[model samples]
Target chain A: MRYLTHKLIAFLIALMLAPVMLAPSWAQTPTLNIDVNVGIREPVPFAVPIFIAENNGAQAVATEISRVIASDLISTGLFREIPAAAHISGVSDFNAPVQFADWRAINAQALIIGAVSTSGGQLTVKFRLFDVFAQAPMGDGIQFTGTEEGWRRIAHKVADTVYSRLTGEAGYFDSKVVFVSETGPKGDRRKRLAVMDHDGASLSFLTEDNAIVQSPRFSPNNREILYTSYESGQPRVVLMDIFTLQKRDFGDLQGMSFAPRFSPDGTRVVLSISNGSNTDIYAIDLRSGARTQLTSGPAIDTAPSFSPDGTQIVFESDRSGSQQIYVMSANGGEAKRISFGDGRYGTPVWSPRGDMIAFTKILGGQFHIGIMRTDGSNEKLLTRSFLDEGPTWSPNGRVLMFFRETPGADGAPQIYAVDISGRNLRMVNTPSFASDPAWSGLLQ
Target chain B: MRQLSKAAALAALLITAACSNTGGLFGGNGDGTDVNGLNGGPIDESSIAYFQQTIGDTVLFQVDQHTLTPEAIAILNQQAAWLNANPTATVLIEGHADEQGTRDYNTALGGRRANAVSAYLVSQGVADNRIQIISYGKERPLAVCSSETCWSQNRRAVTIVTSGPGV
Candidate 1:
């Protein structure tokens, strides 16, 4: 009888263990169902007050740093910057002891402070982040030294440091954004290649032309750009040195080349090549110009992007009768349709993190910014507007930059950025209209 | 007069056919292919209106800038003449960017292209209310064959005349 009881007890224990062990396997099996993405709500709030100057005449620099930091943080839609007027404690000095009680009164969970000094033409800046509730510095303070012309950069570095410490993601501040610059009327529009600091400072035009250029993508090293230009009159992919402004076109191709992007290693370029009426995505070695075609179909395939690991590519194709995003092996295998929703997806840009791909989706005549997993799961639409396209990620993947066109009394496009959380949608000001924002990785 | 109209219509038809072939004036096929190879669709009325008004001419810009060229100013001056004559006409300045930059920059380039024209027309006594600008960026092309000839043709802004409301 005792042996019988032991067997029954053993059976009960095994039954409990079976469900626990089998749960993950059941979850892993593939199934077909429409997965609607309900997005995150109520982003965390933090306070970014102007860092106190270590000396006199540093107030302007301090103020500018604080303002830019606030803008960067608030723009991500993850952190809400506390208004200076609402602050219970005024920060008077960078080294001054913090009054945690005052910050807690205003419900600030995290705080940032910094100090700037100038000596020998190089600006030395120090900053600290704190967890107010824990009453401890979030991380050790760091210092930066650079020319006065790089003050904005110092601010960006500070913002990046704070962002990384808080979110555990890479920082995109201190990066450069390269795009086409324009002037003139519609039929007579003049375009020049241009680069600017990611925050929209230090603008420089790279090309002089009616030489048409399109889709300039920065190398992973951030030293070069691969773009398509009409300099020779036919559409061809060209490589340009960012520092020297020297450019060279890729060799002898039968068809037109456009939508050029770099592999994560920057060794090969993925672009769409058109021969007569046929268009397909091809990978070409930057040095040898040896080419490999990834797709061969009657339909057009363009906008090829390499997944972070360089193992697969996500691109836009009209293979299914309308534009949609597709995933395929990096070496050109059978392509799988990943976007199975109601809208058309274009410009599928694989995220730097390798986990999600960002894209522009058009549905019901409205353009939206959206993200989905690498395999096309968990698709989340981040922003919707009258017109929004060309999404590029901040180095940390927290923010996206794209152009927003509000039909002016006269129809012209305006540039705008929205956080991935679908908040903090605001215009990114330019002297003229801006679009096709390609965010650079953080300048190391 | 009938011959003149037929010749004008034939010229208009040819120009429309060319513009539609480039895929710049109306919505692009949205496939981001060579604009020159886009011979898939018919030449619609909008392309005809765009061509007859400009007669295959587009605005011009100076080197490395989207600011209107003197030729563009003259075109707008002429456009002001045509719009004043047709009081019911509303103009949509479709913007184009040269193929030389990134797509986003080209979109902005296209906008600046439109803005330069819109601003000039406003100064030339065209009601800002009657003019609208839409930047198609490098998505539309007047030339699809890879060549400087095609690129130059692609880098243009064309003024499209629409009958305001109820037309």
Candidate 2:
């Protein structure tokens, strides 16, 4: 019966959109067309009431799930949630139709209704989104089932669905971040590896503070992490399984190695190795333990990040007498410098969208987090601070998270996230001082 | 006159060192002797302590500069003479930078600075085998404050005797 209802709703939505889909481009053209190149600055007004509890002992989970979904949407700075008290009608039945007139009267552009049930130690959630302006359901309802402990992930999935459907872009809510958690004082700082949800929840420490760790990066497969550890009294790249916590050092290539980033395929890693004289970039095949020197020069070339397509690598080098961003073939060749700005550029991370590169810029004693086109045009600075570096792109490439260090004896570093449009800059709440955040691909 | 204040500062440092459980500010490995030359006895001129206290262990650089100045060269010349005399001691040259640059570039600049000092010591007859170098970048700062005074002090390369013969 539920499957038939879903099919009917889907067909109805298709029928409703047929007219707009069939309209010719020339016929729909207007004399005054507004080019909305910029993003939507004003938050869209939406409503998410408390989900209905369909089974005994499911009311608490239903309420908490609804709250999580609402918070996730609001945190993106793109949605404004209308309080439940503001609604003229309450949704008490899972099968009842939405009162679109009541929602529209309250100025709610979008409405979400959901129900939760539990049976045989499994939790199930069903949700439907409605377009109040059109006085109709936007699409067919969907359901998710999982273990009770995985309720937050299910909530994130629902939020991701709503965000994607409304914005026409992929949602980054269902992602994870790996970073270096720091504690103790400035002189004797201790660091460990930590992973957390994208909204700074569900944090789990991956390593102890016995050894110094830096620059933890997630593999494209999202099952392992690559980081630099000083366990042997010298920095070396270490790869560890995110689930098993088993780690192995890169086979003895000599010298100190740091700044390891996985290739797009997750089969290899590119890192910086210093040989007492100069530091250069090297790519290592993780399985075969074979190494290839990508950059061979007298200058320092480090912080290598591969493009999304895996055909090229973007890195920072001092070949031009100062630090600048450069790009070269994945197999290694003469790197063409891409950044010609007045200051220095380092830690250039290619966006997942493959159109821009986010980098840390240093100029006039201040560090700025900025983005530029791949060919080094359309530069825009998103943040400026005493010390801000190490930018990691969100899975959707619409946001960036970086660490900012305050200046003083008691100064501490904290992680912060900013939209690519330079609006909605917010600090990510961490247990303690944190830096070097790396966002994981969407979880399976 | 400057020598008198240097002695006074050494005395003050030793007085504080006596109160702390850890070794002096530099934390030399449980050595009872004053490494900062506070006792003023017949000091071992060939000792790393003497080289650090008298010839100066660190040379400061300008912002974003890896080149050594004439003053830095004079100090390195003295360091080379001391290292040549203490031939058995292996030295580790640690390069540092102020917190004004990105971590990666500052790391490379720190490497360049350490290399510059190492190359100068080799040019002055110090064997390359006796010296090793590392760049801490801006990770480890000698001065925690953010002013120019602190930044100047943090942007330095210090030569330390890591192992081998001791004075």
Candidate 3:
């Protein structure tokens, strides 16, 4: 009877502590903790090691991918990267067992490691994440394969998987960017449309060097681009195929057409047309060459972008005297002015989720990239610089890609990306000048 | 050939006369035959003459729009007639925009304006291959002002004569 009583008492004690023990292991972070929810606390602390590839193995992919992963995670501002120099143990092998005690000694609550290999003209990468306290993987390892030059994209996919596993949110690393490549002096500049991976790799030009091209936006699938070019020597919207580089003018608008943005459905493009000295918003079907006038009147109705549902559009207009953002139905109707702030706003691009509108704000002689709700409330500026404009969203709507121009002694322009929270502002490395970035949707 | 010699002699006489008549009509700033002072203010007669000869009859735009006015069409018709006379020369229709919009959009708007003119030129019997369109959105402006008037003048499509290839 005494033995039976002792065993029952032990069972009762464990039952009482079961709820406490069942909580998620990721709930605690001594270095940092990001709630990422309404009324949440500080950011989470995580350590990402440079993925180790074998000596003759995926050396090129291993280093490139680790950097992209670091960049993507650091840009979120919800995680702090513990320096690699501070690591207690170096990750020297891909399948080498992790020492949880060593990671804990460095106070890393979460850890990441990856490995790369190449065979048969294909590159394969596999990565794993761990919860040090839980003494297990936070999730299963991910494996991907691509070309050697496409190593950055593979890294981005890995980062995306890791990010989604931890935050329950979609990752945007596996994406691409289309932007304007600028050269020559400011007065007589030569601009061309260029596309690259999201981390600035595999850059290739789409237009010839003769005529200037700008504001290149990718179609939903990222297989085509819609931009304005002076190839015909007039500012008209033109569509270019990514693979063949074949281009066709949008339509015979009989006037200037510009600020072309593909609709959310990707079948139509909304742009501005200057008919008889009056510029208004117009939508053109890429398939049928059908045209629909959206904004009527002479108030510089340009930069038309569709909402996520394709029901409404956000655009810039000087109808309210100074340039400001306005919202109207996809079919041109009475537009309600949404900008009531202290500055002028233009290039109002709708967020992918239909929640916010990103714009370029100029106030007090300063240029800023800002965002506000569709109703034009809760306006917040993400970046303030001498000149920063042309904001594009990541596939997941968590980050933005834009360009910054510093009137340097050398006269150079640079491209940059930042989280919507105004954190992790970093320069995207490129050999030449880059501007007017348009982020593409997540690659399949 | 006789007309060329007569014009050269007339130009020489005018230069000497103008040099002697300095500080009177041409005035105190050494602004002789050169209409350099014309750049600082409103369109002067000498500057208008220069514009008429060099820029010809050009149509301007309003901010981001690229529609031509009746007056602009009339000017374009004149340009088309001139091109019809000079069939051997290829013309580049250059588009421009004001500084009111984003540079990228403005660049596009400029292209649109240039294309509009190119299409019109083609419709007027100017061979499609003879005309090339290019947009310079808000990059090069004739006037530097944020006002409506300046913007109106900045949005334009000017016909530029292209010397033969490699020239």
User: What are the fnat scores of the candidates, in the order listed?
Assistant: 0.00, 0.42, 0.17
> Could you give candidate 2's per-residue lDDT for residues B1-167 as a string of tens digits?
21332454465455445434334444544555544333433345765456666688899899878789999999999999888887787777878888888766666678778889999999999888887777777777888898898999988998876654442
Reference-based TM-score of each model:
0.66, 0.86, 0.73
Compared with the true structure, what per-residue lDDT tens digits does model 1 show for residues A287-354? 88799989998566878899888999998877786778999999998999999999778888988878
CAPRI grade of model 1: incorrect
Q: lDDT for every model?
A: 0.69, 0.81, 0.71
- Candidate 2 residue-wise lDDT, A123-201, digit = tens: 7888887778877665567788776666777788889878876776788887889999999887567888988888888
lDDT of 2: 0.81
Candidate 1: residue A68 lDDT (0-100)? 86
Query: Residue A410 CA error for candidate 1 (Å)?
Result: 3.2
Error of 2 at A256 (Å): 2.2
Docking class of 2: acceptable
Rank the candidate models, highest TM-score first: 2, 3, 1
Winner by lDDT between candidate 3 and candidate 1: 3
lDDT tens digits by residue: candidate 3, A1-444: 234323322221221110111113434333222343332245556788888775476776677778888777766666667888899898987677889899888777778887777775567777777877777776566677666655666677777876787777788877778888888765456777877767776666666566667788889877788988766545678988776667888656886677889988898998877742357888888788899998877566788889989999999887776778999989889999998999889889998978999999988767899899999899999998767888999888877888887643234467898777776688887768888899989876
Which has the better lDDT: candidate 2, or candidate 3? 2
Candidate ranking under lDDT, highest first, comes to 2, 3, 1
Give the CAPRI class of candidate 3.
Answer: incorrect
- Position A75, candidate 3: lDDT: 61
In terms of DockQ, the best-performing candidate is 2
